[model samples]
Target: MTTNAAMQGKAMSVEEEKIQGGVQSLEVGLTVLDALTAHNAPMMLKELSEVLSMHPAKVHRYVVSLIRKGYAQQLTDGRYSLGERAHAFGVNALKRTDMLELSQRYIQDIQQHLNCSIHVSKWFADGAVVVQSLESNHVFNIITRVGSRMPLLKSATGRLHACFQPEHIIRPLLEKEWESSAKPEQYPANWEDFLELKAKILSQGYASVTGDMMAGINAISIPVFNFTQQLDHVITCIGTEDQLPEGQMQQAIDYVLGVQRQIDALFHPAAAI
Candidate 1:
């Protein structure tokens, strides 16, 4: 007694349901990966379950599958972190021809020249992320790791981005972060001071932070511009006060600038003017 129109409509509805059902498992798996990524560190099973608001048993099942697929790994302590496959994917992402592969040699050259920790950050929708890093041979251990998010109003790279990027693109993000802080007074004393700092960074073509994130540690950040003169990536040099001596500041700055010039020559040759 089913009419032809009713049969066609039922067929279409069934097809839509099937399509949605097909992706449900994949979507759940990705949700697990995303939660781990946001943590940026290894987490225990119960802790991860709490964060995801899922039952421990369910999370365990997903984690086991992820481990089998090499997307996640279980540490000796039974904590879970992103495994080899995930890191390999990140490395591959960084090595894309337009960015890391082209600049890697320069990064190495700068590291060898300064003998300090070097960080390369790329702008993301949320903020800057450390995509690559090189550790120096010195005993000083700078603990920054890849996938770490940069502070918008605090870190040297964050301030550099604020200076080079358009106000429309950067202001809202800054305001949101400011509002999130339980202590708003901790930010620049006033808006004028913040603007002034941005101006200074632009004029100097770099920004520096000393003992802000970590006591006795210091860092200098320089911007890289793409062919369109837009912000591309930021290079940050980090070390203790002794490692980055006051006398060597200019030399390091000059070397970093030279490297930026070389990158611009290749990536944005016509716009390098």
Candidate 2:
């Protein structure tokens, strides 16, 4: 009995090292915050613990701490939700960030010069792409905004990221999302088609499609790379068929790619994307 107890105590001691405190607490806190941000509704203690695979006791402690610190609040149903402090922090972070500042200027320039709608997005995770900024000058409008997320398999930006991604990373990510969406409704048909499209998007420096988002509303996209040559962001321009004929699409692409280069320079001086 004594030997078993000692072994159990040693195992727990090792596990406690993984509890995430000291400087790591910030990351743990961010992890919780991120999960909350992704969810549309407030989460119960059990839901949060399940989502993070954290112990309820530990999660409760964090939730209570965040509540006391004004970053979270408890609902009448006892679920934890983001408080005003979270929104204020996010707003201030965006206000001070260079990405949006640079993205906005470039997007506006593209709109003024090309007279089109521009979408700027980043790869937030393996299976979702989030639009961080958008600009439209003509009568038509782009139906995306800051914090809007799109699925990996269906969205143009998502497809670009998938095509540019290294095979090892792309394959696993594809498989993971596929597993999650294997059921009815959202399940993708013809895996072979997806593979073929990804190959084409890779070969073409930019991807262009018409009627993907809406009929007559064509879209073109170019993946921007950071200084390290990693696909860091994407810039997409949208226009109607009447506004951009097939013959003029190449020129439009060149113009947009140039804008992308300028924005890339502004955000990452030495980077291309």
Best candidate per TM-score, number? 1
**What are the per-residue Cα lDDT tens digits for candidate 2 across 23-87?**
67777887888888888689999999999999999888888888888889999989989988997
Clashes of each: 0, 2
Task: Look at candidate 1 and give me any clashing residue pairs.
Answer: none
Runs of candidate 1 exceeding 4 Å displacement: 1-97, 180-187, 268-273
Q: What is the C-alpha local distance difference test score of each model?
A: 0.81, 0.72
Best by lDDT: 1
lDDT of 1: 0.81
Measure candidate 2: CA RMSD.
20.7
Estimate the TM-score of every prediction: 0.58, 0.50
Off by over 4 Å in 2: 1-104, 166-192, 261-273
**Cα deviation in Å at residue 264, candidate 2?**
5.4
